[model samples]
Every structure is written in C-alpha cells, then in structure tokens.
Target chain A: MTARYLALYLPSLATDRIRRAEPGLPRSLPLATWEPFGNRRVLTAVDSAAADVGLRPGQALADAQAIAPDLLLRPADPAGDARALHALALWARRYTPLTAADPPDGLLLDITGCAHLLGGEAALLRDALVRLRQVGITTRGAVAGAAATGAALARARGDNPVVVSGIEAGVVAPLLLGPALRLPQAMLAELARLGLRRVHDLLGQPRGPLARRFGQDLLGRLDGVVGRRRVSIQPAIPPPDLAAIQDLLEPIITRTGIDAVLDRLLEDLCAGLRQAGLGARQITLTAWRVDGAVQEVAIGTGLAMRDPAHLRRLFAERLERLEPDLGFERMALEARATEPMAVAVQPSLAVGGRRDEAAMAVALAQLLDRLGQRLPVHRVAPVASHWPEHAVTAQDPHDVDPTVPPGWAAQPRPVLLLRRPAPLEVVIPLPDGPPSLLRLQGLAHRLHRVEGPLRLEPEWWRNRPNRFRRDYYQVELASGVRLWVCRTGLPGAPRWLLHGHLP
Target chain B: MPSAAPDVPLDQAAVLAALRARVTRLEGFGRAQHNLGAVPVCEGLPLPGGGLARAAVHEVLATTPGCGAAFCAVLLARTGGTILWIATGRDELMAWPPGLARCGLAPASLVIVRAERWPDALWAMEEALRCPAVTGALLALAPPPGGGKLDLTATRRLQLAAEAGGALGLVLRPDAACADHTAAVTRWRIGSLGAGHGLDDPRWQLELLRVRGGRPGGPWAVTWRAATGRLDLDKEATATGATRHAAG
Candidate 1:
C-alpha cells in the first residue's frame, strides 16, 4: 500500500500569533520578529506587510532600518512560537490522529486513509487552509504521494502538490535548487556560479562528481524528496489521561448551570482517578464558549487528592473569576498533573491530636489556595546560615511544611529583617566612635544611647573577595526609636547603613 | 454605671447574678479561653483569662509614628503558625523577614500582603483572620480619614471573623488618635523607652489603656529579653503605680 502525507509551513508563526491575539492592530504596518543573533539583532520572522516591502528573514536590524525606517520590530518568542505550532498540531487531530510538529513553524500529518472522510485530498487541504486562515495564520501546504520530505519541500517552495503519485521528481526539478533543496548559502552560491540554479540543472550532472563535491547529504535529500526513501513523521502524543468533557444542548449562561456541569465533570474525573488509584495535583477547566473563545481556570492541590468535594471547592473559588461571556456550549475538566493518592488514612479511636494536625494541614492548604488567588503565598523555611538574609528562604507553600522554626526562641534577632540593609546617613563623632545622630529617608533621629559595635564579617573561606565587614550597633533615638546600624568599608572611608530595628 | 436600686431584695440579686453568668457563658466569655493563647508579657500587666484572648481583635497604638510596628511584630512572632501581614505599601513589610526572625518569629513563617488602600487592607485582614491555618493576622494601617471604613463596623467584622476562625487579629495604628468606639477587646499604647547601657535590653513603656471585661493597667517599663522569649518588668518602678481593677 502507498502512503500519503501533508506538510503545512507557517513562516511567520510568531507574528501570526500576535496578530490573532491583537486583531485591533493595524495589519498594514510592517511587523517583524527580531531575534538577537551573535552581536547584532536579525529578523527571525516577517509578516506579509514586511515581506511585501522587501525585508527578509536573517537581515540585520540596522540594514533593515536603512531599507524601511518604519519597520516595526518585536522580540521573537521562539518558545511561544513552538507552543503555537504544537497547538495547531493538536487542532489538526480533528482531521487525523497522526500529526507531528516541525519546530520553529511547521506541522506534518500522515493523512493516509483519512482524506476520503473529508471529501478527498484537495477538499482536506482547502479545509485545513481555511481553518488556519480563520485563526489568523497564513499557511502553505502540499499533499504528495508518499514522501513527507517532498511534501515539506513542495510547501516551502509554494508549488502545486504532486498528488498523482510517481511524479515527485518532475514536480521538484524545475524549482530553484536553493529553496527546493534548502541548502547552505555557500553551496547555493557555488551552484549559482556553475549556472546550476534549478534542481533540473543538478539532476543533469553525473552522480559520481556530485557525490564527491556536495557529499552524500544532497543525494539522501534527493532520494527522500523523490520517494526513493521512506521518511516517516513522528507524531506528538496527546494528553487525555484523566479528562471528562460535557456538551450542552444549549449555551449555559447562568452560574448555577456552569457549577452543575463542573460538579458532574469533577465527579466523573474523580471516579476514574479513584479506580486508577491516582490523585490529581493540577486540574484545569476549559469552557468552550459559543463565540469560539475558550475560557479556562486552573487550581492545584498541595497534596495528591482524589476527593471530589475538595476539588469542587478549589474550582468553585476560581470559577467565579472565569467570565464565560456569551455563554459556553461545552466544558472540559482535565487533570493536567496527577500522582498516586494515599490508599488510606490511618483511623484513630478518638480522632486525637494527630487527626487535628492533619485537619490543620488541610485547612492551611485551603487557606493558601484562597490567599494565593489575590496574592502569592510562600512558606518560610530555615536555612543553615549565619548571615541574617541567608538564615531563611521563601519557598512555594506546597513544598515546605508551614510549621514554627525549631530553636527560634533563643535567637536575639529583630522582629522584622530588611530584605537588604538600607543606608543611613549618620553624624559620627569621627575618630571611630558610635554616631551621635542618624538620618533615614531624611528623618533625623538623635542617638540618645548607643550599644557596642558588634563586628561581624562574612566567612572568609566561604565568600569571595570584597566580603562585607560590618560593625553593627544598636542605637536608640531621642524620640524613642531603636535602630540597627552598621558601619562597613575601611575606617578611613566608612559608610554607615541602617540594617534593621528592635521594636 | 450599675443602676440597681438600693432597695433590691437578696433573692432578686442572686437571680440576677445567675442569669448574667448564664448569658456570659452562652456568649463564649465565661470560658478561660485566649485566642492564640497568650504571650508572656511581664507580670503586673493583668491580662484577662491569664493571657490575651485568641479569637479577638487587639489594637496597638504607637504614641509616635514609626514606633509600634516593631512591637506588633514582636507580638506576632510570639504566636506560632503562619502569619498574614497586610499593609498598605507592598515593600513596607518586605524588610521584616530577618527582623521578625530576631524577634522569635520564624522569619519565613509570614505571608506579606500589600493592599493599596485601608479598606482593602481591612478586608484582607478579615479574610486572613477567617483562615484557620492563619493563627495570627496583623494589619499595619495608616490612620484613616475620619468616618472612613476603619471604624467600629469594620473592626467588628474583623472581631467576628477572628473569633469564628479561632485566630488572633492585631491592628497596628501609628500616628492616629484612638477611636472612642471600636470592637477591639484590648488596646495598648506603646512608647519606646529606648535601649539601656552597654549590652542592656531594649525597653518599652507599655500602657494597657483599655481592656474589655478586665482591668486596664500598666505604663510599666518592660525590657524585652531577646535571648529568651520573655518580658522582664522593672519591679521597683512599677511599685509606685496605684492598682486599679475592674470585674468582668
């Protein structure tokens, strides 16, 4: 049996995504994706407006500026472009399950026997192109007999497809060798010097000399392009481990209806998770609106949990934030991240302190979830260090136990530690004594009493050169304010800084 | 303020006392329960139920601006578990992690929340107080404009929330006169006495201006010993004060 493949190339995937996201932007403006290349910035991708104005990819930003002063440049997001390509691949799964992403901006699909369902190869190609256009991406695609690489080359060359099989070479021969073969600039220059600009020019030469000069890569590519070699497309695996979808007969606009659907979906998902002995750490709810927009809300659990009630509560808080304007016709609940849940919690006779502690942990987790909605919530964990700032670290609440630090009572530390020591202008007695007055943020505080200069220096072996050597003092102002000040640098040119306060 | 007639019978008085006891118990005031348990503030400073109530609102007023925040931090450090510190300025509380550690609070045990206005700060505090995991919630509020949201109504909501969640709610108001009517169960005026001679402890004059259902005492000089989590009272100076007590 013969194979069939289709390759779609989106040259300006980054700019296309930007255009789709901001449809209000003027399309006539010359927009291009700029990327840092070596010591200079180069155009990585260009929109049709920029392309029409004769700006090409890999052109230096300075050179482009000389050509078109009105050229609008946006920093290219390569990662985001890749993600968009992957999403397109996923969307293509509606046509065929065999879809793979060709990075930077391309997708490959093994349409094989699936084209007939979409009314033959031409209809399928038209459907794909039309859908991509609706999504704001300009695409070029081709369907070839059995060569995946040939279809890719055909798309890249912007040529009609070789759909009739056995004519791959005929279709590829007349195309310029530089673009059709995707060769290096030096090789293309040499080929041009030899008056061999087209594939047909190279095809007329004897194989022996071509192998000796251009090496085996050219022959391999040629073989792959002409169906002599079978090049398979590796499809990306989809994630649907624990997901439930609900379709409504009519659009649901009310909160109650959405909540009901979410409740049913969560129950369905948790039932599957329970049967599989797994718990979800991250859950995402996507609402497919009637207006073709997708509204999504996501929540995470500190502990691996399969309890439907808890999951519903977490989603409930987030659901209020998701405004499904114009209503939604379908909703999907997916557990993006999951882990094995504890089979059973030990049952105590009276539900004693251990139970209370467990309940407290759960309460804290819920509080964290709610608090994190408005602002970030972090857990403070003690680190083994003598430097004040290095003594503790803020970590994700899920990763650390929110318990009191051990041996915290013995320390003589300030109530509030500054993220960094702030500088304080001081009126020192000058010959190495304590300051008589200190000024912070332009507020003068006369030092009524002064404590010792507790000289603390960074560990010499642990730290690099220019390690801080500070003489700390506890100073009290006449207005009854106590401050922690430090004197650093050499005694001849010492700088005074306020470190903290002892309330 | 007791308006009972002098001619009241003994049996009637006994019935009245019994009824009041029942009402107090039903209202959750008869129990010797403190919200976050209590910090060991020096002796002679009488605290009802042997310590401060856990599920109640307490106000700390700084006699001077920029003075009471440290005191509030010290009180918060004494309460174990995670603390939610909400203030108007985002960066205002960022500098407190290390200093909070020195004051016996696990430096990392706090979640700092920045709100743009007093109302938002008050709302965040109330919400935080209702979270059981948040054993303590402290709000450092700049004095609100008169008749603003930081009145009896707002503090009352905070009080109810703290009580419901069994968490302590502390409001630190610097550079503001105390409101005549507030829902706070206790109010303390804090003034710094400054640090002592070389190697001496930091001192503060704590005045227990008002306390609901208990005696208001102090204006007492207390030295906070950082090495050990305890408050040392200046016994000789405190002896001159006339004792005043009120029955709850």
Candidate 2:
C-alpha cells in the first residue's frame, strides 16, 4: 500500500480583535481598531458590525467614530500578535513534527502519517479546531493531500475542513479561487482582466501563452498549489540532540533548587553525549517560567568537554543571571554539534621530545577566561637599531618564534636599559669626549668611568622632521652606579640628555 | 616601609618555593619529568630540583623614559605565558617593544593594562598576578620613587599569589635612582654600544650588575638586526674600563 500525507492549514488566526478577546472578547462584538499617527489616527481593523456599517481599515478614526459612536477601539500590536501566533504554532506541534508557522496567524502541519492515530483526516481536523476553540482561539483547519491544496481550500471557502485525497492534484486544481493562488493584488487584477479569474481558468490555458502573457510567477503559483512544484520550509534554527524537557508539578524559584535541577539536566546531557561518543563545546540552559516566558543562559568552553563537573562549574558562574521570576516550571538542556574527541597516538622513541604545548595552551585558555586578558606577558625580540629605544620589541607569548636564536645576550650590554636615553648637563674636563660631572634627576654626580659615543642617526623616512641624532654613553656614577645616557648632535655639540641608568 | 629590612635571602627562598609549588600544581597529577612536555620554555630546569621558579618576580630599572623596559617585559611574558603590560607615567614613552610580532607574541596574547598613576598601576599589576588560572606574566612601568623605602610588600603578596597560580612577575622601574639595596633577584642596566659603520647593525650593551647566582660586572653586547628581528652577541665589543668609585 502507498503511504499518504495530509497538509493541515489554519487561517483567520492572526486578526487582532479576534485575538485580544479576554476569554477573548466575544467574536460578535463590533471591534474597531486604530494605530497612532501624528495628531491623527489610522483605522486597522473592524468587527462584523463595523464592517457591515462600511467602516473599513485605513479610514480616519475621527470619521470612524462619527459613523459609529459605540465602536470598541483598540491599538494595533504587531509584536503581541506575532507572539500569539508563535505560541499557537508551538501548540500545533503536538500533532506533527513538521509543523511550522505561516506567520501573522496561520500554521502549517505536515501530518504525513499522524492522521490515522486521531481516527481520520476529518476527525483530526475537527479535534485540532475543537482544542483551539477550547483555548479561546477560534480556528479553521483544512486537510488536503498537498500543502498548497490545503491552503487554497482553507482560505477559499469557510466550509468545515476540506479533506481531498487520492485524486491527482491537477484534477482538483480548478476548484481553487483567485486569492487562493497567493499572488499580489496587481497581478490578480491583470489576470482578472485577462478573464483568468480562478485557478481552473488559469490552468486551462496553454502553458507557453500563459507564461508569455501573465509571466512565469502566475504559472509558478498555479503549479505550486497543485503539487506540480515543490516548496520547502527553512527552519529558524536546526534541531538539537536530546530535546529533553521537564514539566514541573510546581514552580521553583530558589537558586539552590535551580542549580540542583541544572546538575541533573547536565548529567543527562553528558550521558547522551557519551552514548553518542561525542563531546559538546557549548551548552545552553533554558528556564521556562510559569507565565509562559523563557530565560536562557549559554556557556562556551575553550575546548570540547564532556565532563559533567566542568560543565556544572561553567554554568554555575552564570546562574545569578537566570533569575526565576514568577517561578520556573520547566528546564531544558540541549547539546549541539557533538563530535568525537581527537585522541593523539603516542609518539615513538625516534620522535622523543616534550608534549607540554597542548597542556600549556589549555591552561592559557582557562587563565584567559578567568583574568579577562590582563596579563602583560609577550615575546620580545631585538629590533635593528643603533638607538637604544628602538632596539627591541615585545610580542605575544603564544607566538614564540622558533627560528630566532636564544642566549644571544652574552656580550657587554647595560643590565639596566632605559626606554628612552635621557640627556644630561655634563661638565667635560677636556675639549671633547665623555663627561666628568653630570647633573641628573636634580642631583649632581661625578662620573668615574664612561664608554661609547655610540651615535645613531634618526630614521629619516619616519615622517618626523625634527628627529635628533643621539650619541649614547655608558657612565659609572661616583657611587658605583652605572647610567646609560645619550648626547644629541655631534661629540662637541651642546644638546644632551640623561636617558637610562643601571640597577 | 624602610626597604622591608632587605629580606633578599628570605625572599629568595620564599620565591623559589613558590615557583616549585606552582610548577607542580600546573603539572597536576603527572610527575615532573613525565609532564616535561607541558611547559617547553621552562623545561631547561630539571624536575624535582627547583623545576622552575614558582613565580619569578624581578625588577628592571632604567633611567630614561623610553628604554627597553617594554622589550624585556615582552620577553618575560612570551616565555612565561599570558602577559599583561601595565603602562604608568607618560603614554608615549610606554609602548610595546618593536619586533614583538616576530617573537610569536601576538596582540591577542599581549594585554595592555593602562593606568594613570604609578601606585594604581602597581596595584593593578599585583591584582593581575594574583589570579591563579591566569598562569601568565605581569609587567608594569612604575614612576620614580621619592624615598629610599621602596618596599613593595603588596607587590610581594601579589608575587606570592602569582607563584601559587604558576605565573611570573616583572616590574619595570623607570627613572629611579640606583640604590645600594634592592628586593629583586636580578638587576641589570642596558645601554647602546658604540655605533657601527654603514650597513652594520646597532649594538646594545647590557651590564649585569646584580644577579642571584651569576657573575656581575661583565658587559654583554648584543647586535639587534632590524630586518630579521633577531638579537646576536657581539663578542668583539669588550668593556672599556671600570673606574671604581667609593660608596658614600
């Protein structure tokens, strides 16, 4: 036997007045609505009474009021309407796994093999409508062999849910109305002018002429509704593993209780991961409150981890942000994109060396998470320059250059290096050369021994016009203290400053 | 703070113990020799025999504003782990050492912690080192001290924390006078060697005045080649001469 699929369509579900009825206001009330405008109002919707009195949407609210003084008015709320539609869609998920929202106020359910459980297609439709009405939502459902057929049948006629099955889609294609074709109003008008007012009228024409006259869009819509074309629903988010949910017998608000529940959930999630031979790098914990609101907290790890203890520790830090307002009734934990851990094979004796790099990386990641990147550790290298300040640069620790030679500082260099060599007021005994007396840091010191007139010309290409030529000298103060100073200009020139000193 | 009574010997012991404990903790359940692959940089030190300084804290004092303080900090940080560069005093003077990229220290691993004042900068540096999970290095540029009592007890406490956490600490003292007493295990003065002819690289002369277990007074000249970002020892450049001066 061939398998059968049923497409269930819900329509007229998103109207605001029909939705806002507390017990949802009686559907019989004359509901007129308006939205805010600059010192004016624009009408949004009208109930059966107001519609009968010619109070259509987009009419002025003042004119609407003048025409019907007793009209019950309410503001249009698109967000609230969307939320209600979303909730209804979730509720519809009980009937099938492929249920999706049609937006504004409709739901599409691909009840492929689920109809027989509720008796038959008709019975399923009736059961769904009945449940919706009981929840204060007046709904209409149509079940057809295909989604387009069901949508067309549900919107074309107000008759009880249509159940068309077993026939080829083309045979019943003519019965669908113009609006059921789901085309824009202008295109519909053009089709109407061409005398192709309904699906049957459009389908009877030659394919080549129809495509030439009304365009492929009209033909495409016709083909789509009759099952000649395929349409796929793109889900907002991909489904995750272990969609486990706990419905509380009572609400829970305490942090300890929430943490306990989380612990249990994490264990279950970990068990699911282990069973699948995988680990999760990120986990999201959601708390569903009694008032139909949900709060979610997500924690991500540096590496894929399956340990429940570590997962718990990560989540514990974020628990304070998940306040259980009005008490939480349900908790859910989901693991996404599980993959097997990449285990490394032991190396042979021929390739002997330390294997601590990975461990160090993991430790570094943990430290980064805790400290938030405040460590000033980095790799340093000597920059090419005669100027002391430009001689070296700092790099990151993780980026240690393997190519650079080590232990290259065994020659004579000042242990106490200055960032910028400072100038000094020096009193030289002779006509040229190193200073004998120097005044620096507001103190006078006698120079005992001095070395170098290491002159470095400024980097002319750096775009700085007034760059100085420095002459550096390593001077030993009278107290056995060594200092690194630089003289600007020539050996006999006046510009000089004391830059750095040894410790 | 009377210079903390010059507890160099006690400080060394405490510092070494702290470093050993940190290395052990970082190594976790594995034996020191077994986990030798974990910290390749510190692997040069033998296990169970002071594997690595728990958290080695040293001071680099320079007279000039733009000396190679940041460069030394970067080296220490890259070798140690994560690095935090705390810049105090003038903004222009405090910068990342050049050629840092060639050394493997990227911007992501090097964190520049900015502070307006010296004391605050020191405090911030201490706090950064206290985090155990950080397992990195802390480098700060301090202002010139006005008195002889440069007892950084709070800094010592922070160093202890860093040791416990398995990190290294380096404090860059800028524009401070050279004194007879110091709390650091190693103290060095870096300056420029004599200029070379055209096409020859600039040579840097480093004088190791005070080292915990190493000889002092020998000047180490290193030639910094800009194009390659590498430091080379210039063995030909000998120390000029030492004119001994009597201590006051």
Among these predictions, the greatest DockQ belongs to 1
| Candidate 2 Cα misplacement greater than 4 A, ranges | A1-66, A70-179, A186-213, A241-251, A286-296, A316-323, A335-340, A344-357, A369-503, B1-52, B56-135, B139-161, B170-248
Q: Per-residue lDDT for A385 in model 2?
A: 54
Model 1, position A427, has a per-residue lDDT of 89
Model 1, A213-234: lDDT tens digits are 9899987776777677878887
TM-scores of all predicted structures: 0.71, 0.54
Q: Which candidate has the top score in TM-score?
A: 1
Worst 10 residues of 2 chain A by lDDT: A344-353
Candidate 2: deviation at residue A465, Å?
20
lDDT of 2 by residue, A189-210 (tens): 8877877776778778899988
lDDT against true structure, model 1: 0.72
Q: Could you tell me the lDDT of residue B213 within candidate 1?
A: 70
